[model samples]
Target chain A: MSEATSELYSWRASIIKKQLMALTGLMMCGFLLVHLAGNLLLLKGSDVFNQFAYLMVNNPIIIGLEWLLLLVFLMHTTIGFRLILENQRARTKAYAVRSTVARGSKFAFISMSVTGPLMMVFIIVHLFDLKFGSEYLVVQSDLEVRDLYRTVVEFYSSEVNVAIYIAAMCATALHVQHGFWSAFQTFGLSHARYNRLVELSSDVFALVILIGFGMIPIYFLLGYS
Target chain B: MRFTLRIWRQAQQETTGRFVDFAVEDIPAEMSLLELLDSINRGLILESADPVAFDHDCREGICGMCSLVINGRPHGPGAGTTTCQLYMRSFADGETIVVEPFRADAFPVVKDLIVDRSAFDRIIAAGGYVTVTTGQTPEANDILVAKENAEEAMDAAACIGCGACVAACKNASAMLFVAAKVSHLSLLPQGQPEKSRRVLTMVREMDQSGFGNCSNEAECEAVCPKEISIGHIARMNRQYLFAMLLSGERS
Candidate 1:
């Protein structure tokens, strides 16, 4: 009540943690959108897809953005885990039998706790197969540039890898389904008329990201590679 | 009407409690839940038994003093109505009703159907008031306010500080109560000065009181006697974030 000594610092830290979560969530959602758009280029054939990948890694501006991307992911994940742990600690005892009478989006609320850690593992495996793993690489065009297009196609050509990729994309979709609009709400960007539009747009965005990335694995699995 | 009641009874704050069953017969259908309890208490007194010690004041439903979780629903089955407003007719004849005190780590059971909700009072005390000069009242129109803003502020102001939201929440979070208080003040012209500091201080008290974080469960809004929306929680989150993240200033 007095804005006492120890409590003030904890309050500041809690609010700061929530803000960081929203900021990093927005950044990661943006990254997912751009990543989806670029991945869609794979359908246009190997030349265009490889060229896009080549430019993404070679361009100084885009390369700098990757570092920023890493920073955002690091902050988002670290703070997310901290908030989850703190929230868990806040409730001293669990109800003998708990039931939610509120008309909550139960799927969205419960799945976030699952998809977040799943996405973390998915990102690591995804980077290894496409970015760092050299076993799947193919040399192309006399310039000897690594053919990232072949790397993606060959990686997905295995049924096991394709299954893993699809599973990860599903987790991403579920995470964004809740995270997209939640980030906006956390920032206080709500109105009676406009919030409905935001919710609709978030659903569409989640679907597009999932389906767009979903096609590549299906394409390679279907012998189109 | 005759009904069976299973009520939670605790010996003290340090001991465990359990449900004690009683058959309450010959009750009128129009009797309010509190009246039904009163009838049961009179019967117990005649038998030289310890009567239930639930809290109540101004049983007409405005005081927010009545706290009961009837049939596992806070404030009974009705939406936007308190326990005192709930009548015996809401339940069928010869039915069993289970009543318990609002549960939360911060709200310990004081006795049968009573909890120490002083936690809410502490949260309100943190920053629920505006600092004003000691002088004559200002003219009503001295500070122009938008009509819509006034209405919204009044809506948030309808909260009775009842612990239904805390009881309804799965994690026993008090976000709705805090949001109502925060937005009620922050929406008005007089509340602008301490807007940033108010949110920062109140939320800190909420966390320190050992209440859980809001998972957007929305049970609070569902069971609220005033039907306060979770939208206020969003507004509180926004204000708290903006104050700490962008301004980077204490006040």
Candidate 2:
């Protein structure tokens, strides 16, 4: 192969794919933290949450950032699926009976295959449900913004909708639990002294995020409509 | 100990392979797993049946030639122990043991229990060595490597090329093996000159050989006979990223 073409072929290397996955995954994790912080305003009631949502959508800078986030999400999901498909192709014949005995959590390890596609589908449905669900997204006279707070509450108030939200949140927790520390490992941040700390902090972050978003559905489920 | 065996049987790479059942009686528990296979092959020879073909050399375990997936775990159940080091005593009497070759598209079954692992050789040939002049022997103190780096390099150098990591990986990824090769040499002063180009060529070769991407499941570390850590893989990632970005290749 020519030098230029070989350099081009290097981009298809498995390590490159893994690096892209880690980079995009960490970026999405950052977005998750910010999104969770904003969602917490749901606990402060409708006006505060609606106005926060309004600012997020209407402000030009925030809108630009939102577009950037969409691009990040697109990259993450695309690379994620590519890795999954490539991995599946690598192992053409499945073992008749297999067992994975490893140091890491098995659920977290295997859940990547499950949670990745689940989260992608959920993100799509979620975007539609919140961002463009209804034509009645006009600014309310009192709140002076779109009633996103009411949209969230209405979405979560249904038993079926709340159930789906909770299930998706669990998947998100599992995905983050594995991906968080793993992203650091991919970036060569794994030190003997800090490995355990990274794992512990990742677990804590996953749980906190899970409960933070999960509570919104519980709040509306408990006759708070 | 008497055990029923379900061993994969194939004539060649072109033919489909399947598990065939055999009963072995009056076997001693003190025999190593490979020795047990030897006895099974001995039985087949006496019966005029085709014997099982597996790979092994320097059965004391340093050669990394022994490759077997015993009861679905690569190199058997013992952590950091190769199949040659695994003994029959570890199994219960009358236990059913299923044995097969490592399953991966990159590893084609050469016979019953042997798969062609020359893919690893090709990957190594792609860029596992440093280019240097060989003439007069240089003084031992010519290049002073840090103690920590030396130790780390030694750790990475322990990889046996057994292909266990590939077998253990759910994705059949060889990142651990390739990382070991890359990190060991790159840790030293002698290997520095070719560091960037070496990593690029080796990694590209690995992908071309049809190995899968690592998902950081760490099954490779768990099953490695040398106990080679997945940290090597992380280090390789760092090296590869630094090389790619520094080389100005972004896609």
Best by DockQ: 2
For candidate 2, write residues B129-166 as lDDT tens digits.
98778999889998899999999999999999999999
What TM-score against the true fold does each predicted structure earn? 0.86, 0.95
Residue by residue across A36-99, what tens digits does model 1's lDDT show?
8898898888877877887788999999999999999998898777667666665554444344
Candidate 1 per-residue lDDT, tens place, B1-251, comes to 98999888888888888888889888888999998889889988999998988989998778999998888788988789999999999999999888888888889888888899999999889889998878898887998888988988899999999889988886678889999999999999899998888888788888778776665657899999999988898899888877665555554
What TM-score does chain A of each model score against the native chain A?
0.89, 0.91
Model 1: docking quality category: acceptable
The C-alpha stretches of model 2 lying farther than 4 A from their native spots are A1-5, A105-109, A135-143, B247-251
Query: What 10-residue stretch in candidate 1 chain B is worst by lDDT?
Result: B242-251
Computed on C-alpha atoms, the DockQ of candidate 1 is 0.32
Clashing pairs in 2: none
